[model samples]
Target: MTDAQEPRRARELGIVVGSLPTGPHNALTDVPGVRVGHTTVADPPRLHTGVTAIVPDALGPGRRSLPCGLFVGNGFGKLVGATQLAELGAIETPVLLTATLSAFRAADALVTHVLAGPGHEATRTLNPVVGETNDGLLSDVRARPVTEAHVFAALDGATGGPVAEGCVGAGTGTTALGFKGGIGTASRLVEGWTVGVLVQSNFSGTLTVRGVPIPADDAAPVPEGNSCMIVLATDAPLDARQLGRVARRAVFAMARVGSDFAGGSGDYALAFGVPGGAGDTPPPDDAALDPVFRATMDAVEEALLNSLFTATTTVGHRGTAVAVPHERVLRRLREAGAIPR
Candidate 1:
């Protein structure tokens, strides 16, 4: 899309999220060897769901898995392969995200893709990580329209660099904080390590930015059970234990964007670290990890804003979800001195 036609990110609108500086793309792809792709099915009033794939290119060669961690803030939804990933603290397949009912199909497709990789002929077992959020508000979710082809397309088409956000992929049919919600990503550089976060937002609460609540005059009553899925990638050489700590920060960062963490919000976060090209670098001292944890929270907070800021109004099977009014938000931020006038 052209510059005028392209959706704008939060930073572009003068809503700077944190003190940290973002990477070149301000996206998950900033981490070396990490790629993101989306397959959106926008059939309008009937269907608006699709699949998103996050491929950690470092998983090939002599390495078959990356140190990974998962955190579940609420467990009200289905997440395929979560138990295995948490138990092993490693991920062998590219992570996939899709609508609620289609999670199983996406997981199956992810397994097929991994097994098809070179040197997997003898592999008898594999765990495919897949996450989901309810998108029935904007799609015919019961139809489970996501097919293997869609999942494969996202995986094979994954690439590095800029990522598409808002109303795409698994976020196509999602809503958040009284506004349209979709895929969003942000990256931070801390202690020479790149920390990137990607989020699929679909929860509800008062919208807040930089401690300022942006009232939603058009706020509509949304369903009770919704969720947000987060994925964090870094080249920090952190072990699964450390990554788990970082993942916890990501889940808590949701509150910065005003998530209620309600009884039915299936808030989840998965963090994985890819080793350096030379080899696995020794993790920094635990005391030095404070910066990494702070950066993770900052990146997660910005990512959640991006999901709301870039999303456009969407009319789906259930009803209409209006996009957050940028001007109104800016005015509120200015009044609160959160951003320069």
Candidate 2:
């Protein structure tokens, strides 16, 4: 379907929120050259797991990569290849997100995928950007079932449109705040630019949406073990350092929604800018970014909101179900006069 048709479809499917309109695709892929793919493992009564690949830019051969940055809010999580990205301020390959225990296998598979693809000269050293969240609840983490084939499938299936969320991809077996949480996404427009956020929604604590708490009486209690990995992407020109700052801003956004980065919660953010004119040039020095910085913060804040807004409730193994009742939530917000009738 066309991009415009996608958002209409999302709304029809009861998968949307907030006042801001979405970009062409309403997904991270809406950010120019960004592309997304997923590989979901749905096996019978249980075993909910999957992988997601985010392809930054698909420019023809030898073009410079995107300027990127990483932020570890708590560092209790496992993030592969972050050191190199932080040191070099560039991500030469697609970013992969998956279950925590599948990290090693995913990283290995990513290396193989990159090496086997076009433009590999055998002399190139690969850094596969793989991030994860614990998904032991629904799948057998010890099995290490995810392989190079699954990684490749996700990468090859990547598309640029409204992405599937909630019990899909890396969010298959995730939980948040003692409830059922999976994946969610949202975007914002700042100074004619767009910033988008995609989150693997495995986190803890009472979920608050735009300052309004999802009251315990109104929703399920927070889960005991939870964590989250947030991926932020934008088309704006931001250097690795600036992107790092943007990444931290996500924490504020998370806090605004009531996440205290509680113990046992692996809250992390990875931010990157899409390569545009002149390809991979460093962003303007900090002093010169005063205007851009303001815009970046706004974008980051809104993106976090989008992540929560687009998520829906899901059911997992052993008949465990979590539901984010949109109608009930809207009713609560209306009672508080948070939205117009």
Question: Residue 77, candidate 1: how far off, in angstroms?
Answer: 1.8
Query: All candidates: CA RMSD in angstroms?
Result: 2.3, 4.7
Tens digits of per-residue lDDT, candidate 1, 1-341, equal 11223468999997787788899999999999999999998888899899999999878747888999899999988888899889989998899999999999899888888888887888899888999999988899999999999999999999999999998999999999988889999999988889999999999888999999976665474733569999999998788888899999999999999888888889999999987722368776678889999999999999999998888888889888888888888888899888888
The top-ranked prediction according to TM-score is 1
Cα error, residue 301 of model 1, in Å, equals 0.6
The total of clashing pairs for model 1 equals 0
The lowest-lDDT stretch of 10 consecutive residues in candidate 1 is: 1-10
Cα deviation at 297, candidate 1, in Å, is 0.7
Per model, state how many residue pairs clash.
0, 7
Question: lDDT of all predictions, in order shown?
Answer: 0.89, 0.67
**Per-residue C-alpha lDDT of model 2 across residues 108-223, encoded as one tens digit per residue:** 98888777766675536877788888877666666667888889999989888777766678877666654556666656655456777777766666656545777544445454
